[model samples]
Every structure is written in C-alpha cells, then in structure tokens.
Target: MLQRAFNKYIDNFRGFSREIWILTLITFINRAGTMVLPFLSKYLREDLDFSYNQVKWILISFGLGSIVGSWLGGKLSDKIGFYKIMIFSLMTSGIAFFGLQFVTSFEGLLVAMFFIMVVADMFRPAMFVSLGAYAKPENRTRALTLVRLAINLGFAAGPALGGLLIMTVGYKGLFWVDGATCILAILIFWIKVKEKKKSKYTDKEHPGEILTNSVFKDRPFWIFLGATLITGILFFQLFTTIPLYHKEQFNLSELQTGLLLTLNGVLIFFLEMPIVSYIERHKINKLKVITLGCLAMAISMYLLLVNQWAGILIIMMLFMTFGEMFVFPFSNSFAISRAPKGHEGRYMAIFTMSYSTAHILSAEAGMDMIRLFSYQNNWFFMGTLGIIGVLLFIWTMKLVKYEPPRNI
Candidate 1:
C-alpha cells in the first residue's frame, strides 16, 4: 500500500518539460541559499541590539524593497523578457549579500536590508512568468506545486544549515554561503534553461505595448488583492513574530527555533504536492480549498496561546503548515487563471505585491503589538486577522463572479 502511494506521489513529477524541471532546480538552489531572512529578526534583536521599534522599522524597509522589487520584476519581465531580469536580479542580489556583513548602524543596516530584498525579490514575478510560459495550462498549477516543493525542500535544508553555520562561523558565514548559492543557481539557470519559444497562445504585442496592461485598473483584482493581503499578514507572521515568540517565551536557542521552522518545510515538502495532486484529480473547488486553509491558519494562531508547551508549539506549526499548503499555491493558481493575455506579468506582480505589502504590515504591526501588549495578545490579533481573511476570501470570490480566464 505504501509503495503504491509513493509511486502515485512520483507520478506527479512525470510529463513536465525540460524547462519546467530546470526552473524547479533553479528554485531549489535559490531557496536553499535563503539563509539570512529567516534569522534576520534574531540577528537584529540579539546581535545588533535593535529595539523592538527599530527591528520593526528595519523589517518595514525589507517590505518596502519587496514592494518595489516585485513590481519592477513584473514590469521588466514584460519589457525585457524574464531572462534578463532574472540574471540581473540573481547576480546583483548575490553580491549584495556580502555587503550586509559590514553594516552595523541601525540606519545603515536598514538600508542594506532594503537593497537586498529589492534585488532578491525580483526573482518571484519573473519566476511565475516563466512558469506560465513553460507549463501547459492544464499542468500549470501542478507545475507550480512542484516548484514550491523544491522551495520547501530547500527551506528544509537551509535553516538547519544556517543553525550550524551560526554556531560555527557566525552570521557573516550565513551571508557568504547564501551569496554563493545565488551565484550557483544563476550558473545552473544560464547553462540549462533557455528562453521559451513563443507559442500559439503567446501574446504577439510589442513588449512596450504589453506593458500598458495594468492591474490597478481592475476592480475584481483589487478585491482579490485585499483578501490576499489579509491572509498574507497572518501567514507572514511565521517569519516575523513566531521566531521572537519562541525565543522570548521559551528561550529556545537558534538551533531549536530553526528546527521548529524546519518542521514546517519538512511537512510541506512531504505533503503539499500529494495533496494538490489529489485535489486536482478529485476536481475540488479551489476557493473552498483556500477558505479551509484560512480557517486552519486562524486556528493555528489561537493555538499559540498555549505558549511554552513544546507539544502545543509543534501542533501549532503543523496547523500553520497545512494552512499554507492549501492557501499559498492555490492563491497563485487563482491569480494565474484570471490573468489576461499580454498582462500575465502585471497580474502576477499585483498578486505577489499583496504578500510584500503583508510583510510590511505584519512586521511593524506584529512587533508593535508584542512590545505594547503581550505575545498572547499578538496571537489573538493574528487569529482575528485570519478570521477576517476567511470572510473576505469568500466574499471576494462571490463579488468577482469567480471565473477562471478562458485562455492559458
């Protein structure tokens, strides 16, 4: 029985193109190098001696950079093609990692973080555009699931390695290793991936003409974006608030905290692809899947109220992981299904920007709540936000008439 189940899991990997596999490999390599961001809050609080407010501001800077980068990535992908934007983003951001080691002052560090995120985040929109271009319409969502599997697998490795690096050679080593990994991803991509040939469905407009297609002018998209931002605020707390909660509430060491997060990645790596495959095979409604995810996320936040209990913490992470598995990849599919021809980049960027915006709201608001009230209160607030997200998601779909775009 287990053998057949494992074979079914392997079946999901079949039928993808060479480019899709290459992109998945690139995603894995890039995500594996993502060592710095997960531990940035801890580094700021412990090593740099940042006040809660200062940490908040620094995170806001990172979010601001994400906003700029995600938008720019889309615009550039539409204008110059995904290739140039990706190569430039990867190479430049890799170099910036080395620079982060030298910045000490709060203002300087904030600026450094902003620049790193701006460069690093350019990969997202470009990557999605590439995914859309490479995968057949029917396989697009599954392809995305595969990419995310690569990401979660890499994430499962990165933090554990980061924990070891921190103990052996400090945060500076994290910077160096992460920088090298980005460069390595770039090398693999340059060698293995080629620009996809234009297909029958490809928009034939001039790149400049295509650039005129705008997401800001779409009302339904805004409703969707609003729902996305609400969910994102709660989802992003995994990176921002949860780490601090573990450190302060339980005095968990860096290794222990990294392991907690690793549990999230490990579960997703094992479960998400299979679950998505089953959903697709079973013809489940995407919106229903997403709503269930939002409710689960809200419940997870509430579970955090049972702080200092290791078993409860693990259970909370489990709920959060399952919620993310349901919410995030389907959200990508939802946006992609709605994208009009000649405007895929802009539509994707807007959706991506919702999470970027959440990073800003999540960090500043979350940290401030922890500082002013208690962490328990912060969890309650996050739970409330998640509940609001579930309502908004349901309403947003109804308001938009909920049709997938007819074209791939």
Candidate 2:
C-alpha cells in the first residue's frame, strides 16, 4: 500500500512537480538526520545532566534564532533568489548540527540549538517561497499537501532510524548524519534546481521596495495572520507539553513517547492528500477545515484531561492528529492566497514566524503552569487554548475572504 502511494505521488506530477520533489527530498534527508531531536531532552537530562529549566532555555534559544532566521531568509530570498538562499541555509544549518558534536556545556548546546533552528527555519522560507512561485491557486493545497507528506515520510523514518543510530553511533552521531544530509541536499539543489527570471510577483516592484505598507495593508493578510498566530500557539502541545506530560504523569518510557510522536506523522502521511482532495472537491472553504482542526484538537485534548487511562490517551492522540490534518495544510494554502505582489517569501515567512513565536509562548505559559500545578492541569489548559483557537478560527473565517479565486 505504501509503495503504491509512493509511486502515485511520484507519478502525480501535476499536484507535485519536479521542484517539489527535490525540495521535499532535501527536506526529508535533513529531517531524517534530526529524528533524534525527540530524544534530545533525554540526552540532555540523562547524559549531559541538565535541568528542566536549562532544557527550557534550549527550546527558547532555538525559538529566538528561528525568528531571526525566518525574517532574514525571507528577506534574502526576496533580495537574491530561492536557489542561493536555500543552498546557504542548508549548509549553515548543517554546520550548526556538526557543531553540536563538540558541545560539552549547556551554553554551547544552547548556541548550537539556536543556530540549528535559525538555518532550518531559514531553508523553509526559501523552499516554500519557491513552491509558492511554482504553484497556482487551484492545485496549491494539494501541492503543499504533497510536500507535507514527504516531510512526514522523512519524520517517520527519522526517529526510528535515529534510535538505531543512537545504539551504534551515540548522540553525536545524529548530528553528523544531519550535517552530511545538509551537504548532500545542497549539492542536489545546486545541480537540479534552476532559478528562473523573477516571477510576476517578484518583479512587480523594484528591489529594496519591501517595506511599502500597501502590501501589509491587506485586511485579509492581517486576518489570516491572527488565525495562524492562534493556530501556532495551539499546535505547541505536540512538542513542548506532550513529552513532559508523558513522563511526569503517564510515566511512559521514552521509546513509547517517541513512537507516539511518530504515529502523529503517520497519521499525516496517510490522510493529508485524501483530506485535501476531498475538501477541494466539496469546494469547502479552507477556513472550515482549519476550524475543524482546532475543534479536533480541543476535543482530543479535553479528553486527555478527562481520562486517566493510558490507552485512552493514545486514542485521544487521533483527535489532535485529525485536527492537525485539517488545520495545518489548509491554513497554509489559505495564507498563500493572501500574499500581495512580489512578497510571497515575506508573507510565508511571516506565517512561519507565527509558529516560532507560538512555541516560545506555549513553552513560557505551559512550563510555568507545570511548575506550579500538574501535567493534567496543563492538558486542561491546552484544551482550553484549543477551544479558544477554534473560536479564533471561526472568527477568521468570518473576516478573511476565502471566497475569491486566487490571482492567476
């Protein structure tokens, strides 16, 4: 079944193009290298002997670096082009991973983490901007869907293989693998990807004309940003809170937790294309799917707070997964519709920044609560947040004009 789907994805050249495939391939390779990150706190806490607070700082440092990287990458992508920007991002990110091999202190680890986030996030603005350039409105959702599936495919293999690598290669081994893939991805991009003359969007304005507020003045862009900012905040549970909950409350092994997270990726892989296609066929507004995403998360998370049983907790994961499937790709497609002339990279980068900012917010609010109350309480808090997110999503739909066709 999986093989057939893989072949179909390869053959379905309309939804995903050659550029999408190569870009996703590079993403897959790089993601496969860092699959060990799910295990990072374990290594930090158990091996390097860092505290929860120190690890929190690590997350924050990465978040901070990602903010700068995202802004710079988008800005640079606009100034130069996707090809040069992406190649540099890939290598810089890889070198940062390689640097992780030698880190002995918390400060060193934080620095490495920061740069890694910077470069990885930077590559994305370039890549997604490239994608936005290549695709049109009608097939855009499916295109983004395919890219996401490729990423999840990489993630599915990354953690499991990373576990094996850890057994044989140690913690530093993962970084080396990531670094190597970064180099390889860069080479592939240099050879296979070609930058064309700037698209209509890119060439609309003169160079250095980015700060013109007319682009930012789009009411739809502001609405979607608010929608995305809230969505990003709610999505934070997957990384920041879930692991802590598993350990502090459920007492699950690290292996079990890893598998659970992997399961989330699996859900995305199997369902993303079908869901996007179905919604597109129904002519359903993308905002509707995004709203359901928030609802799914809210229900599932609320269930987690209500149920004490581990089995139910696992089942509840499906809710969040289903919610995510609806919300993420659809919102991305929706956001792309809001971009103004010549600013696709900057717009998408703003969307990316929303998530980076959300993680920092989630960790800050969530960790303080965990420090005071229990993980169960944190679940309830997140559940509440999800509910609020759904309201925001509904409000977003009312405001944003998902009604119009994209600018061809």
Best by lDDT: 1
What tens-digit string does per-residue lDDT give for candidate 2 at 181-251?
88887888779978755666554445445535534666656666776676676677777777777887789
Question: How high is each candidate's TM-score?
Answer: 0.89, 0.88
Task: Identify the runs in model 2 with alpha carbons over 4 angstroms from their true place.
Answer: 1-15, 201-211, 402-408
- Candidate 1 per-residue C-alpha lDDT over 1-408 given as tens digits, one digit per residue, 9 for 90 to 100: 999988988997788999999899989988888999778888999998899889878887888999989988887776677777888999899888977888989989888888888888888998898899988887888899999889888887788789899999998899998888898898899888877643455466564444344355556557667878878888889877898788888888878887888788788877888888788878787878988998899999999999758688888988888999999888898887676554677778778888888878887789889989989999999999888888887886685555543432
Q: How close is candidate 2 to the true structure, as a TM-score?
A: 0.88
User: Looking at candidate 1, what is the lDDT of residue 178?
Assistant: 88
Candidate 1 stretches with Cα past 4 Å from truth are 41-55, 104-107, 197-214, 246-259, 305-310, 400-408
Model 2: worst 10 consecutive residues (lDDT sum): 205-214
lDDT score, candidate 1, position 129: 85
Question: What is the Cα root-mean-square deviation between model 2 and the actual structure?
Answer: 3.1
